[model samples]
Target: MKGFARRQRSVLGVADALRLGFLGLKARPGRSVLSALGISLGIAAAVAVLGISASSEADLLAQLGAAGNLLTVGAGQTMTGTPAPLPSTAAAMIRQIPPVQSVTATAYIDGASVRRTAEVPAIHTGGISVVAAEIGLPKTLDARLESGTFLTEATIHYPAVVLGAVAANVLGINAPGPGILVYVGHEYFTVVGILQPVTIAPEIDQSALIGFPMAESAFNPALQPTQVYLRSAADEVPAVSRVLPFTANPAHPETVRLKHPSDVLEARAKARTQFTGLFLGLGAVAVLVGSVGIANTMVIAVLERRREIGLRRALGARRSHVAAQFMIEAIVLSLIGGACGVLFGGVATLAYAAVTHQQTVVPAVAPLAGIAAALAAGSIAGIYPAYRAARLEPSEALRSGE
Candidate 1:
């Protein structure tokens, strides 16, 4: 209500409000810092959560986007997600679909052991379609070499293997140099090549990858493919889904199953909405307490300045002027706290990302949004106190101590 009168004072514009706020902060540096701390904590928590959310989203998209029109298997309503079966004959027939760009079967190898003499347990091993080298894995793996190259179409039929960075060192496939022979599963297989290190997931520590056909035919017939990756055109996705038996059924018709990012994104958004509401509620509580604190301070300031107010009224100053000064001071306090909160909050986000090993990435607008929110909340919280200050009668205020 008194905002216009507050703005009427050229000497008490936003610039002056800022300057006087600094004066107030300087008056009680300890209290000012403590007040700012609450806001800082609130913003910091929001920033950290936002950073993690962004990382999760980016990681998902990165993993999925790499497919380049590819589709991975869906777990069709079982105890756990399982890879559906598609025989070589059936897969070859699925290529008949107009939208099908490429088809490949991938199987993850669990409890796999490659022994030259002894066995090292708990290594991640899997075989993907031969096309995985062309599309799925990174190009750095392409540059890495040992005695041979990454497997090809011919190698799928032959007994060839590529060793991961860990595998090459542990088995002594290439000792201080080039090619050496190693035995995997009692079969005399040469270590055709050594691979650059690749992560099964960035979160995990160790794993290995190989061709699925090797696991199925040569390694263990009991071994089953955990997934199949397929690529299709953008417009063809709907068409592909119609044929692929993504749903649970005994006599499935299609060879491949497709999943889209939009479905996952919607689910994540719902989860995020829950957290966002929680943080907003906590922030509201903090700001409310801070508002109460400000109101108490303003009341004390007015009581002490009662005589000064009367003297100003006698000198022809308006009641609104008195109210404006008190209100501006309160808002000024909040604005200062808000700005400090932004700085500390930013530091918190950076520290968390560094400690967690996730990427240290933040949205550019978060800090700005935080600061704006702070100012808006402060202005709103100051209204009632400002109104009470404006309504004071000069005569009564002058006689207060008497």
Candidate 2:
């Protein structure tokens, strides 16, 4: 009698489990595809958000880096309301600092207005001013001569002057040489060069520049620098900023105004972080909606396949086999969607980067993390349906299907 008894099979082999899992999907291709699509949309949204944000941040950081290590020092009003001026040797003193790369100064010549002709109406000043610049001015500002040459030792004491981009436009002087001249103050200064628009110092755009020596003799014999620009090593910017005011004017440190472009760059980076967080939240909501869709699809599958479950159980199928079958189906469906979503997101990110002229930057973890999340969601959604299918008694399930 014992020899006639049947052998019990408690668990399924890996190959058999996979075959069973795929059978259900193959039987209902349309339903499986629709379910997978929902998950794909969610994964695409998350991946795209991470990719675009990373690329945008990289572009912004690169632009900020282009601003270089620059520091600007200018004069401020004293407690007595007097305009405190920088010392004549301010540039020389700043250069003494080891981290300081180079220094240059410019003095604003008061009551100077440039004009196309001395006959141009005084009221039509064209909003241009005059400044006495040192020989190292262009190097300090990192500016280039668009037309001619910058101030030289021989040209400094003469009537030679350089026009800024805006100043040139204002005076209607396109080409500068020996013949082209613009009236600066009461003197006729020959236009030796024209400078491109300056990014570091925008005020230069609306000002005419002459040599320090010429500015002293013609406009101000007691000429002193009103502003000083300096360059330093990248790591020494903060340390240099703190000691700059005292370095420029040990006598009137309180009256010295010190500023850096790096501060503005940092503020901009902080602003970008806020937008990234908002987009990430939207992506999360999309993923949540996908999980719901998966759960609904799995529930329907269980309800429609009662006959199948009953027949398998009537044979040799166990509860664990049934559960594993449905669970694997869910996971496979999710992975399909996730893979398609990754492809779509990668394409979208590349297209955007090309249009915006920025380098494409995709985080390596984005795709891997997205796939893992999809699998987790699928497994969680499959649990209740798998349990319901496995709990049905074979005779009852078969009869209900009839």
Best by lDDT: 2
For the record, the alpha-carbon RMSD of candidate 2 to the native fold, in angstroms, is: 5.9
What lDDT, from 0 to 1, does candidate 2 have? 0.85
What lDDT score goes with residue 107 in model 2?
A: 92
* Steric clash pairs (candidate 2): none
lDDT of candidate 1 over 1-402, digit per residue (tens): 865665443233556555654564466667656665655566555655565556555654554454335555432333355545544344445556678776544454544456554343324222211111222333311234434576676665555666666666655556322335544554545445666544322211122345555656766665544444456786777777766653312255443445653465456556876886687678667766766666666566666667766766656666666566666777777777677766766676677667755666667676776777667666765677667656777787688745
My TM-score estimates for the predictions, one after another, are 0.64, 0.70
- Candidate maximizing TM-score: 2
Encode model 2's per-residue lDDT on 1-402: one tens digit a residue. 777868877678888877877887888899888888887887887788788878988986775665568889998879999999999988889999999998889999888888887888666878888999888988877888889999999999899999999999988889898889887778688999999978567789888999998988898899999999999998998899899999999999999998876577667778777877787677667766777777788788888998998998899788888888888877777788888888888887898899987889889988997898788878887888888888988998899888
TM-score of 1: 0.64
Candidate 1 — which pairs collide? Answer: 124-208, 126-210, 127-210, 148-192
Kindly give the stretch of ten consecutive residues in candidate 2 with the minimal lDDT sum. 59-68
Worst 10 residues of 1 by lDDT: 126-135
Give lDDT for model 1. Answer: 0.55
Per-candidate clashes come to: 4, 0
